[model samples]
Target: MKDPVLSHVRGTPNLLLGNYDLTALGYTVDEYFVAGTAVSYRPVGELGVDGHWDVVPAERADYLTRAVTVVPADGARFNGTVVVEWLNVSGGLDAPAVWLMAHRELLRAGYAYVGVSAQRVGIEGGAALVGDLSLKTLDPQRYAPLTHPGDAFAFDLFSQLGAVVRHRGDELLGDLRPERILAVGESQSAMFLTTYLNAVAPLAEIYDGYLVHSRFGPAAPLDGRSILDPDTVASLPCPRFRDDLRTPVLAVITETDLVGGVLPGYCTAGQPDEKFLRVWEIPGAAHADNYTIQGAFLDSGRAPIEDLAQAFRPTDTLMGRRLDRFLNFAPQHHYVLHAAIARLDDWVRTGRPAPAAARIALTDDESPTIATDSHGIARDGVRTPWVDTPLAATSGLNTESDRMSKLFGSGELFDTAHLHRRYPGGRTEYLTEFTTALDRTIAAGFLTSADRQEILELTAITAEWRFDPGAFHQSGSVR
Candidate 1:
């Protein structure tokens, strides 16, 4: 595969969500048409239960997909690391899941970010997990030239994108050299990456590390079956990461992903950590959180402390549907994801692996169940102040209602009686314990120190809103 032709897009890039001000962050956003021919893969030997797949190239097809990039305006700020995200089309559009979740870390650390439209659903039309908002549907004239052969070519199309970021950096990344390239994906895209890592990565050899976020049990099939397919839906097998990994791959599993609601959970595929792979299962976190639907767009690292406080409060709605309970507003999931990006970068650069974490407690059953503590909070897994030195009782589990709400999880605020019983000294004592726990989590390398101040500020806001209601006006607004 030769270097693909890169053409600048004249109009705005439809990233679907998280339309934050890039210029304010000392970064520039650009969209480019990546034109090339991609090779689809076929299994050479047998595709086994253990995720080590043996595959060969079978077919080639021409593809012209869009890549949305966020890079430092000046080349001097470039940190030499580029994160190529597999844009998730589970929502029926090109959604930058990782970018929305961790853009603060990527921008603050000077890493360039590119989101690839590697799947056919994102370009052409298909059955949607959310709405039918494909690129062509969004704007037929602007995205008219863009073509995706099919999801059969997505694996290789994504591989070629990594190559473009690396070998052709001068053209794609504004002459900024990328020393390390990391691949990241969330949910459905993570499933595709699982297949790519097992079947395609050995032959392509593109990325330095991978952040596979919120994947369920089964990896996607090489035959290009959508998750909605009846035959594919009937038999979905849980597969672990291949033991013989050549690069560092960090799997970040959330509580909702552990014991899946609509789909099979990742618990069935749990395995021991290897030299090249580590899994971090976070408790009190849904596959999607308040941050996913709200905070990411509002938090620019430049917002007023009070503004951020207003942004992250608990809400009862997800994409649009009013859920039965308040969605999980715990910031641990977002903070931990940011830390994962930093840890993976350092792991690739210094050859030092990230600190190991305890998996979430689960009950032994034919269908596993997450075990919880006395307060209805999950017991163990990547411990944080929110769950450790608690305020509200939180869990990754929610009423199995709609698919989106189920993944959003649920939270219940502690009543005044429960608050007084837990913290006798009130605000002062609670803050002290919370701060200590936060420090310990940072030392353990689960939370980054760079985020400590913001976390502290947010904690103060939450505590005040709960205990000192007079701090805000009676209109129920942050003042």
Candidate 2:
């Protein structure tokens, strides 16, 4: 494979929800356009239901795409790990969803982060996640030269970017030598990453590991069809990761992803964990929770406790419109994901495997629903203080009246009576129980100790918030 040419881009990068100051965190953010010919893939034989996709290079097209990279300002601070995020266009724009979720860990630990605009929706523009924002439309003069040959070629485009970062790190990272490269994507990008892991990773041999977060059952087809093409999507088959895997894959699933929302759920494709694969099903988590929509962009690792407190507040609005219920503000999804990233890095670099986790308990119904405990929190899966030491009921299912709000999930704090009954001793008793659960969660490897103080601090804030009558603004629910 030929190397792609990289030229520094001189303008404001139009990254959706990319609001953090990398410079303040001892990192520098830059944009570059990588130009080269990328090859699209086709199934070698029939596209089977099993994720063991056999594909070969089918068509070649010349393309130019942009990538935003955040690296340590002082090269000596580089931690030798580069996380390449397949920027999601589910919202009709390039969104660093995973980056938003795990930036605190990445920045604090000195890992470099890169967001690639690989999909057609990011470049050409279509649909609308948070308005019809795209590279071309955001800043015409700056991104005018960028071109993407549809999503059929997206797999190759992503692979090529990984190759550049792996083989030619100095070109992009200066003195930073990348020891391990992990490919991560969420939601729409996760679906595409699932296809990439099954098909392209075998041939390209680019990434050291893969993190497929919040993916639906069916992957984006190898052919040029996207999520927008319902006719083509309806005809495709759901796939499970091939049993014989070479690289390590950490699949993280939330309640909204396991069960159906607007699209098919991943429950159909669930498979047993192999030596190289680990599936973590999280209960009481949503596809896009409060941290995803609000906190991720603002929490830059500086004020960890203060920023995390923001996610605890309940709200019914999304983007702009008011929703039927409060958005799922459970912080477990974001905190657990931080640990997942750390575990993947260790697994790739030291040959250690991440501990296996229980799947979220579900009903036996054909269209399964997550089984919940008395508090309405999902049962089993990765246990956390939020669920075990509960003060409120949180769920990944919410109203489907609004298309975008469906993923935000729902939450309702326990009424004053229920709260009093659950913890008669009040704030002190709640903290004691919450702390015990937090310790156990960390020991079990679901939460990292590096984030322990922050978690405890956030919990303390939650205790104060819930105890304060002024903060309990919801009337009907408080009775």
Candidate 3:
């Protein structure tokens, strides 16, 4: 468990200082490889399955592939290793910025990381292939069409991309036989991870975890929006992909990514009780901005990098004094990654998910609502100022609209004795009324949590035979 020392590049140590500057950053180069000729391909736009666009492959060629090993400057203790595979964002084989970030993070976290260029677009001889596709063109419509099924370019590229990583990862980590191996990808790389998992999961026993962030896919006609829609879920050809996945997955979604909309929807569609589907919804962050902004790719804040840097320091190192110098970036993203890694690590060591926090009851109300406490009694502004009632007190109610409205408004005694009997006590009667109103509100899709609570509480208080200020329920209080 000693902090791993960053190893130096073997031969041509001077070249490392001149080119990539690994030693300057405290990272030791473990190994490096220059892959052979790049693969040449053509993008032929044609209609494919389900009327979707696909790239009809025209040709193939060899290209240079570069693989590098990055280990921490001051190696931290880690029980596992992670392989960072970045999908070609520009459909080129060049090194990606995100890959660099992943390299830095993995090294700092005390895990050895390897980055491989999947295609020839960014590598030597990539110019010929990139020139064929004209990736320099920035038209969204053109890009969208090229990504469809009829075009075999994207599909073929991603398939090969996954193959290359699986081969390289197996070769590099053969002796280490690390306890856990994770494949991390972002954006297009995220989609590549999905493709890889579909094809390689059963065969690749070495891989224990998959982390897909900001996934993008083909667009669906129904939404005509991003392809990350529920409808497009059918587009993925992998059979029972979720049910069959043996490895745990961490699917991260950013609020602003329209292309990632299907992630949450897909997670919800699958069996949530399964340990494999770990979903995290990050708020107020754009796709990959959490890492880019902190890494100085954007002009927002420097705190995230500094925070990560501090985590890299030795235990006895006085990181507290310099903490103030770094900007204060929100830790939610970092924590999300940390949490996923921790869960994956735990599962690697013990054949089960790590202990999870109690499932909090999600509220439809927008105003930060919480459920009843351990006693199962929550007070809303209705029964007693501190109403004592079960968390789902409003579960039972009739479906009729008018009766429901009256019950939710000022408490009213229905002429039918049967109704009162069915509702039981005054609180029950009010809750039934509120539930009905809530049902209607849900249908209309306009009611906020505060509005629903107000309606329910008003109905309850109005029905009380004896009123007392102290007896009124307070909103959000769990009795």
Evaluated with lDDT, which candidate comes out highest? Answer: 1
Q: Give the residue spans of candidate 1 off by over 4 A.
A: 469-479
Residue 367 alpha-carbon offset, candidate 3, angstroms: 23
Q: Kindly list the per-residue Cα lDDT of model 1 for residues 1-479, writing each as its tens digit.
A: 66689999876788853656788778888999999998889888777769889998999999999898889998898888999999998888888999889888999999999999989889987866677899899888888999989898999989989998989887778879999999999999999999989889999999999999999887887777797564785575678899999999999999889888757889878898999999999988889878887788878888788877776677786666777788888889989999999999999999999888899999878878888898888888899999998888777788856676677888888888888899999999899999999999999999999999999999998888877757634426521
Q: TM-score of the candidate numbered 3?
A: 0.45
The lDDT of each candidate is 0.87, 0.86, 0.37
Q: Write the per-residue lDDT of candidate 3 for residues 153-252, one digit (tens) a residue.
A: 2333333434444444444443333445566776545655555454334433446677766443432121112223345545543212344567777665
Q: Which residue pairs does candidate 2 place in steric collision?
A: 91-129
Candidate No. with top TM-score: 1
lDDT of 1: 0.87
Q: Is candidate 1 or candidate 3 better by lDDT?
A: 1
lDDT of 2 by residue, 415-437 (tens): 88988999999989999999999
Q: List the residue pairs that clash in candidate 1.
A: none
Measured on C-alpha atoms, candidate 2 has an lDDT of: 0.86
Task: Looking at model 2, report the run of 10 residues with the lowest lDDT sum.
Answer: 470-479
Find the number of clashing residue pairs for candidate 1: 0
